[model samples]
Target: MPLSARRLVLIAAACILVGILAGRFLFEGLILAAAGIAVLAVALSYGPGSRWFSPVTWVVCVAGTLWTAATAGYWMSVSAAADAAQEVPAVASTLFYIGVGGLVIMAGGVVTAAVLRTLGVRRISSAGG
Candidate 1:
């Protein structure tokens, strides 16, 4: 299931669409949607990369994807209601803040995990040796 360039572009378009549905601001949805895609990519690669990641990491990726998707759906509904009422809900800002905060923490964890994993890998042997 190698992704082609065209497929990647289409995926990016879809992410933007999902992002539009997920946030009060485009950046927020972009963040969450991008993160969701990242997690999905990791989960999909579990077979060949199994040794590099623990089972827990895989579980987290799957769970995170589910949570992010569900929240995006909620965000869509909120937009619908707000549109119908012709006024933004007072709580919408709070929702954005919580979403951004959680994404920041999750992003930090991802960076830290990647750093640790890279450090744990053994150095390659020189061809001359």
Candidate 2:
């Protein structure tokens, strides 16, 4: 597949994921969606031969992952407080789980990207030269 086509597919997938997340978590979902879009944009902006360990890419991935983790922590705390107060909503507990899942996924992605970059991995073109 061409790089452009692959990028388009990735963008489409990100949009779909964000939409689903937003539908489930409202404001939190929107925030996460924005983060996802930002990451995609950064990835797309790189040249085909760009180094994976580019400082900008690393910074974006690290920052985004940390942000997601912080948000997840907040949600967990809220759920715990509500539970203690006997006012816990089922939705709150569900959101907490979702947040944790997002955090894990994002963190894993960042780590994978970092490792790939450190190993000097490059994009493999599908079209045989």
Candidate 3:
């Protein structure tokens, strides 16, 4: 199937929802892990020449990484604060890990996309020269 901006957005949204919902379940960690893997797979599926690697893609990836990181930090802080009064919820921990994993995967996807673009450019230049 062809990858488009709308599709990517939808995939990201779905992954986010999955992570949030799965955090409340027994298999939270496993479900979040699966979501992280799926996000990475979707990001990697885009080719260098595809619009999936456009400037908007970089913006989205960077924004997503930052958002996830910030969210993870916030959750960690809340967990720490709760340690004195009560045990932290499993959902909070699950969300924190999911955020971290998502951040890493998104950043990696951006770097990989840039590398692929560079390699494609080099290949084209060498072939034409």
Ranking by TM-score: 1, 3, 2
Tell me each candidate's TM-score. Answer: 0.46, 0.41, 0.44
Candidate 2 stretches greater than 4 Å from native: 1-12, 15-38, 41-49, 86-129
In order of listing, the candidates' clash counts read 0, 0, 0
Candidate 1 residue runs with Cα over 4 Å from true position: 1-52, 55-63, 66-74, 122-129
Residues 39-61, model 1: lDDT tens digits: 54443333223364555455446
Query: Candidate 1: minimum summed lDDT over ten consecutive residues — where?
Result: 41-50
* lDDT-based ranking: 3, 2, 1
Winner by TM-score between candidate 2 and candidate 1: 1
Error of model 2, residue 107, in angstroms: 18
lDDT (C-alpha) at residue 15 in model 1: 73
Clash pairs, candidate 2, are: none
**Model 2: worst 10 consecutive residues (lDDT sum):** 44-53
Q: Global lDDT of each model? A: 0.53, 0.54, 0.59
Clash list (residue pairs), candidate 3: none
